[model samples]
Structure formats: C-alpha cells, structure tokens
Target: MKTARAAWRRLEPVHGMIYFVPEARRRYADLGLRGRAGYFASRSAAFGRASAELVISTFYNFNPDFVRQAVDGAWDAASPHQVLDARYAAVGEALRRAGIHELPNLNEVLALTRRAAEAACEHPQGRPLFAAHAALPWPDDPVLQLWHAQTLLREFRGDGHVACLLSEGVGGLEALVLHAATGEVPVGLLKSSRAWPEEEWADTEERLRERGLLDGDSLSSDGVLLRQHIEDRTDLLTLPAYGVLGDADCERLAELASPFGRAVVEAGLLKLG
Candidate 1:
C-alpha cells in the first residue's frame, strides 16, 4: 500500500488533477473485510442524483446560516437547471453531429465517477470526494465538485489569484483574485510534484520571472500590484445565495446575480434551491 501510494503521489500533478486507476485497483484488491465494508458503505450510492444533492448539501454545511440563505436567494433568482440542460444538450448534440465516438452515456458517467472515487479511496489525498449519485443523471464527478469547492473557498479567502493562472475561464476564483490583486493575467508556476530535471524547473522559474509575476522565489513588485487590484474588486458582503441589504437589497442583488448565478448553476458548481 505504501509503495502504491508513493508511486501515485509521484505521478499526480502538483497544481492539477490525476486519476490513478492502476493504483486504485491494486488497493481495492488488498482491502480486508472491514475496509471493504467502509468503502461500500460510503460509495454504494455513487450512481445518481441523491448523491449529488448530498455533495452540494455538504458544501453549504460549512457556512453561517445567513450565507446559506443568501445562496438560496441567489439560486431562486436564476432559472436553475434550464441553462445547464441547454449547455449539456448543446455539447451532446455537437458531439453527435461531429460524429464523435465513445461519447459518455448516463451509465458511463456514473461508472467513470465510481472508478475515480475508488481510485481516490485506494490512494487517498486530502481533497474532498464526490461521485455520481442515484438521483442525478449528469456527470456527478466528485473531483470536479471538489475543484469547484476549492476554487470558491480560495476566492472567499482572497487567494483566488492562483486559480486564474491555472486555467482559462471566466471569473474563476483565481481569475477574480488575480483581477483584484493585479490588473492583468497572472502566469502559471509550473511546479509538478513528479520529479523533473532541474533544468526544467530553472527554465520555468525564469519564464515566470520574465513575466513579472515572480521574483526569485517570491511574488515580484508587479505581483504585489496585482494583489492590490484583487483587494479592491471583490465584495465580501455578498453571500452565496442571499443579498447584503434587506428586501430592496435582495431585489437589486437578484437582478444583478441572475446571469452569473445561471452561469454557475449551468457549470454545475451550485444547485437550484
């Protein structure tokens, strides 16, 4: 088990994700009855909607009640699921029209999620686990949810600048952070957990430094300037679902939130109330 975990850790990306299949299969094959019992007990429902709801519920569990209320308010303002369905349908249809083979069905989505979760259990990382539950028909990959949650948490804590450099997207926690902290896009720091030659690390460091984001093992002056921008851009008072003011505030927030809320829901980051 130790050998397998070490290998998996070495293979996993430092700032990205990994799904270690072979290691997972090996671990599952070695589990005793007690381990099996716990595994099945936790994952038996990783085939549907109930599981998805449970995952979302867990995310809301961490916040103050008012935060949850605010999230609910925001959710109510948007036509939840409609935009998601449209997006999914569009993607599916485009794939079909393009004659793409091996497109995932509901069963495949569930199975893939289960496989990933099983891998996670075998080589557990500190990250949260999500899987497709019985009630949801969509791709309820827990890893994706974990990423979303991590992104949100980082954003809430004013650490979203890193996220912006990690992916190409709109207003991701990282993007928001970078936007607020620096008035420009941040360059990525290419440091993988897997060992690479020192030359590669040196090259990466040089590139990042040249971009004015890093300065010899630290953020450069430009990076500092960016952080200032992030501080000014974000509003801490806007809760997840609820608005800052009373009725009037809620109304105004709802109007402003409708589009973004729909986008988030469509991305499957949040659920409809």
Candidate 2:
C-alpha cells in the first residue's frame, strides 16, 4: 500500500495551490472579490444552496466567523457554477502559462486519475464534504476532469479525517494545534490561516500539553503516534478509491504526476517548503 504521506504529497501540489497561488487569487480579484475571504466565498459557492456555516464546518474546516465574513459579500455576486468555472479557467490558464500543462504525458496522468475516480465507489452518507462534491456534474475536458477528480479524492479523505478527529475528541483548534505540533504545518501559518486568536490558541496548546500530547513546543512520542494513527486510518479510508488503481497503477500515477507537481512547486504555487 502507498504510504499515507506519499499519497497526500503526490496530489497536494496539483490542487493545493488554488487557494494560495497568486494566479487564483488574481482570478478572484478580477471577478470583484476582495482577498482570501472573497476567494473562499466565491470558490466554495460551487456547492449550491449550502449555507456558509456548512461550508465552513464541513469543507474548509476553518473558523466559522472567518468563513461567514467572506460569504456575506460573495453570495449575491455570482452563482456557484459561474464562480467555479471562472476559477477553474483562470487557474488552468495560469498553469498553462507556466507551462505546467505542457509536461509530456499530461494526458496519461489525467487519464489514470480519471480511471481511478471512476472505479471508486460512491461517497457514503455522513460524509457531507465528500458527498457534496461527489454530486457535482463531471466536467468534459480532461484537464477539468483531472481537477475535479483530485478535488473529490481530497474531500473523500478530508471527510474521513474529520470523522477520525471527532472520534478522537479533537475539535478544530485542537486539530490545528496537533498538526502544528507535528510540524505538518507551521504554527504561525495555522494560526493566521484559521483566524485563531493568540490567547485561545495558547489555551489550546496548554490543554494539549496537559493531555500529554505536547511537551513544551513540540509533539511528544504519544502525540506522534496518535497523529500517525489518524493518518493511517485516513489512508485506509481512502483506499477504496486508490485501491481501484492497484499498486502498480498507483505508483505509475505518482511517477507521471511528479513532474507536473514539481513544476507547480517550482512556480511557488504549493507552500510545501
């Protein structure tokens, strides 16, 4: 089986940058959005008729008020499909301009991705994040299909992660704290991106430390094991999709996707390093 981290890394570079890259942000701005709030407001509007709270809670997994601030202004500006299509076009254009799409075997990678998605079983109930996305109409072009598939795969694992976290009694802030403690994400970035206040975050850190999950500023041995368990469970949960690809195909997909992923990183799209 592919390691959980490896699977995430291979796909992260492809779709991870949509929210952070200058290209997508500029696209949202061109569509009359203000900043990060506007981008989340516009892009997430694709889930038609869903409340901002639902998007915030289920999809973005960020602070409720932070998401609400964005949706308040974004709802009336454009329909969900319009914002989604525009964002896709703009981001895809950026990739093309950067020659990411020009990579050899581009079609092969997309084809393998789509095949895996098609073979995957339908999203189960209770996974609102995955179910919401799985319900969307498929795009016609291979590029869009690749993006959509990646998006679905992400939500698939995301919903599973949420469930796992909940079962472990880890709420949003604690989840972010744990991730930061493990060095999965930088603490400053997590705090800023999640709109978490300093005092509240410090409190959460204290609680984690008290729980034996943290030792001072870093994760303890138990903390690392817990995180690894969650990740392993997440990988197992996502196996339904990738299992369809089989080990050989999964490895092949990674190999084919690596170059394009590297280009995105080189363009400073994904904030991985």
TM-score of each: 0.25, 0.91
Model 2, residue 156: C-alpha shift (Å): 1.1
lDDT of 1 by residue, 1-273 (tens): 222222112212210111112222233333321222212222322322223343333322112232223233222222224323332333333223322222223233223223333332332122232222212343444333322322222223222222223332222222322332342433232112122345644665566567676666666787676554444333221122122133443343234323332333333322211
Candidate 1 regions exceeding 4 Å error are: 1-163, 166-197, 227-273
**What lDDT does each candidate get?**
0.31, 0.73
lDDT of 2 at 129: 64
User: What TM-score does candidate 2 get on C-alpha atoms?
Assistant: 0.91
Residue 33 lDDT, candidate 1, scale 0-100: 15
The count of residue-pair clashes in candidate 2 stands at 0
Residue range 1-273, candidate 2, lDDT tens digits: 464336446866677667766666666676777666556765466577456787777754577777778777675665677677677876677566557657798788787777766555364566776776677788776666777777777777788889898888888888898889877667888888788778988999999999999999899988998888887887888877788777777888887787877887787776522
Best by lDDT: 2
